[model samples]
Structures are given as C-alpha cells and as structure tokens.
Target: MTEVVHYALVIAHAIESLPLSRAKRQLLSKITDLDIAGRINGFGGCIAKNKTLGEEVGLAETTV
Candidate 1:
C-alpha cells in the first residue's frame, strides 16, 4: 500500500513537471485516472518506456 502511494506521488510529481500547454495539460491531467494501484500494476509494463519516450523529446525524468 505504501509502495502504491509512493509511486502515485512520484507519478503526480512527474505529471506536474511537464512543460505542457493548456490543451496538453488537459491530456496529462487525465493521468489522475491512473491511481496508485494502477501504477504499481502498470509501472513495469509501460512506465519505464514512457520515461524513455520523454527522454527522446528532451523531457526530464519527472516530465513523464
């Protein structure tokens, strides 16, 4: 449970760091739909890849 919350905060912190426009922010904010448990389950599946994607675009670690 604590791990879930930890990753959620990490995710939320990551989302908050994005350099997004209002339209982009709307899309990013939808990430809230993917909560702590969701992240714990899905983190290894795609989250790591997501970090790589952000890197490709010059985004920082927390930007994803």
Candidate 2:
C-alpha cells in the first residue's frame, strides 16, 4: 500500500548512509509492521488509520 511504500522509502533514505543491496536493504529497513504500527500509535493513531495494515498492503491511500 501507499503507507508501506512511503515508510519503506523513508526507511531507505534514513539508512542511505550504508551501501546495501535493494532486497537486503529493504529487509533491514525499519518499515515493519511492529515499527510502523508503533509509529501510527505514537502520533495518537492518525497515520495508517483508515485501513488495517493487511488491507492497505498495496493501496495508494494506505499510509501517512
């Protein structure tokens, strides 16, 4: 979903300091369900709010 992509890109940029393969780098990204969910909850649950993470997995209006 849009949320996942946005989060993934953000994670990727944050860690751009390290040189890494795309797949591996993605794995190392802090864009997991736990972390993303925590982020959503941390801000009073505004981001990633409408759809469940699963449902929003590949949608355009999925994330913050």
Candidate 3:
C-alpha cells in the first residue's frame, strides 16, 4: 500500500509537469480521484472483514 501510494504520487507529479490543456488536466484529475476512491473502498472492505493493519503489513512483507 505504501509503495502504491508513492507510485501514484509520482505519477501525479509527472502529470502536473506536462503541458496539457486545462480540460485534459481536469479529466486526468477526475480519473485519479476515482482510482483513489476505489482503493479506499477496497481498504474499507478489508477492515469490515476484521483484518488489522498489522496483519496487512505482515502480508505485504511476506509477499515482498
């Protein structure tokens, strides 16, 4: 999750530096917002399943 967030931030910074039209920038921003919302909703579902943050971190570490 930390790596994913960091990657998203890097992509956003890259997008901001591009010479895009206002409409294009707004469209990209909306897409980013939707993606973030989806991630948050998925995270919320994990919490609903009674998974703790420590368990999530351990799972991530093992996968790495």
Q: Weakest 10 consecutive residues, lDDT, candidate 2?
A: 1-10
lDDT of 3: 0.44
Q: Would you estimate the TM-scores of all the predictions? A: 0.31, 0.29, 0.44
Candidate 3: lDDT of 20? Answer: 86
Candidate 1 per-residue C-alpha lDDT over 1-64 given as tens digits, one digit per residue, 9 for 90 to 100: 3553334445346666888675456445444544444566755323334465455445555655
lDDT of each: 0.51, 0.43, 0.44
The TM-score of candidate 2 is 0.29
Best by TM-score: 3
Candidate 1 clashing pairs, residues 3+ apart or interchain: none
Task: Give the per-residue Cα lDDT of candidate 1 at 38.
Answer: 58
Q: Candidate 2: which stretches are off by over 4 Å?
A: 1-12, 30-34, 42-64
Q: Which predicted model would earn the best lDDT? A: 1
Q: For candidate 2, lDDT tens digit of each residue in 1-64? A: 3544233213445645678765444443433544655554554223434344334443333331
Q: Cα lDDT of model 1 overall?
A: 0.51
Counting only residues 3 or more apart in sequence or on different chains, how many pairs clash (N, Cα, C under 3 Å) in candidate 1?
Answer: 0
Ranking by lDDT: 1, 3, 2
